[model samples]
Target: MRYWPIPLLLVALFSAQGANAEPIGFVKTLQGGNAVIRALDDSERPAAIGGELNVGDTIRTDRRASLGLTLKDDTIMSVGPDTELTLEEYLFEPARGDLKLGSRLGRGTLQYVSGSIARLQPDAVSVKTPTGTIGVRGTQFVVRVGR
Candidate 1:
């Protein structure tokens, strides 16, 4: 019984730690219709405004839906309808100047605006599409991926 409690306690501790981990970004805005979100290790759900978006979360907009996301480093992304975007990975530790952002866009339009991560580490940001990867600088740009 003692050993069983110990294992249960450890599991609880780890589960609590993961639950307290910070999210990578948030859904700042949504327009037209609902957006679906597939979490890293969870099933798909409807995305709500102000919902936290974790790393590895995939977002999809329906026919006329649009979404705006604000990342931890303040990077802004606007996703158009009929688009699929995934937050592959993101690390933002400004204290040591360590910042990285990687994402993939599957079929739709996206408008990206640089943030502290890009301004501090210009080469650490990348957005991949079906064709190629985008090299992001400290600027805003638009990209579209085709089916």
Candidate 2:
């Protein structure tokens, strides 16, 4: 009876829902012996200790903080003190895997060790900072971001 109105309503509903959708993934681990995770989203402010983590969710630490995360393909990454790292992208499949890690750095350090999957697909892993970008080449290194 009213096809135009129905289509417009459907589009608006879908767009609204999409706006609140959260990205999906898992939290491998929380290291440093005294680190805690805090959710920044409202849909589910779940505790993220070795649990699943989604987009729009932020993991934060106290004065003493550290974290070791194993991505979908077992890629290991360790973050240290007064730092904030966001899991921008985490994609893993049989044929290929891609991970984009972005860190505000704030005032701390981060050490990363690329996993076997990264060796096969070096382009799959990347870290972004205010200074520049760090591309993984199957090597281990530390990144410090601060004044």
Candidate 3:
């Protein structure tokens, strides 16, 4: 009887922990120009300005618009005007010092600055675009997307 109660308690505790754990990080900042920015979750709908961005969030920009994001590792990514991008994946594990970054670039320009995590494990960071993919190596660069 004691053993049964112990197992049941453990199960309940784990279930509760899983349910309350946040999926991923939240949007720290969002800036839009003449174009627009949309966070497809909740009823907020797509607006021509700024809003919260979460994991799996997608942003579309029209004529002359820009957006910037500060990731969990304090890495900065800025998108140029008339572009669309998605936050495909953003994960970090301080325990093992592992980090991963993935995004889908529809059409636009992106500038990425490697964060501390990149310095720690440069091989683990990657960026994906329509044409191909990019692997970071302690370097800062710009990417432009076109038809």
Instruction: Estimate TM-scores for all models.
Output: 0.84, 0.62, 0.69
Residue pairs that clash (backbone atoms under 3 angstroms), model 1: none
Rank ordering of all candidates by lDDT, starting from the highest = 1, 3, 2
**Prediction 1 TM-score vs. true:** 0.84
Residues 1-147 of candidate 2 have per-residue lDDT tens digits of 555686456656764675423234456656554554545554434335667664444555555666666655556667776766666554544453444433334446777777655666777667777777777776788888775
Over 1-147, each residue of candidate 1 has an lDDT whose tens digit, in order, gives 355676457657764675525777789999998899998897898999989898889999998999999997889999999999999978887775767999999889999998988999899999999999998986899999877
> Residue 114 in candidate 3 has what lDDT?
77
lDDT of 3 by residue, 8-85 (tens): 576567646754223333334445554444444533345332344566667676676666766667677778778777
Give the C-alpha miss distance for residue 118 in model 1, angstroms: 0.4
**Lowest summed lDDT window (length 10), candidate 1:** 14-23
Best by TM-score: 1
| Clash totals, every prediction | 0, 1, 0
Q: Candidate 2, 15: how far from true, in Å?
A: 24
